[model samples]
Target: MSFLCLHFTRNIHIHAFYLKFSRILSTQNAYLNRFVVSLRPLNN
Candidate 1:
């Protein structure tokens, strides 16, 4: 029973970590996209 509880908690932690990591990735992607858009006029 204790092992099951530990496993459940670990899964929750991993899920939360991935959620946070994905949020960071999406924010970075958005920033990169904006940067690219801003640079397009300069390239032309």
Candidate 2:
């Protein structure tokens, strides 16, 4: 029973870590896009 509990807790920890990583990746992508936009002058 204790082994099963440990396995379950480990799974939960991994799931939470992935969720946080995904969120950070999305935010980083947004920042990169903004940085690229700023690099080019939009003078028409």
lDDT of each: 1.00, 0.94
RMSD of 1: 0.5
The candidate 2 region of ten consecutive residues with least summed lDDT is 35-44
Best by lDDT: 1
Model 1 lDDT on a 0 to 1 scale: 1.00
Candidate 2 lDDT over residue span 1-44, tens digit each: 99999999999999999999999999999999998788767733
TM-score of 1: 0.95
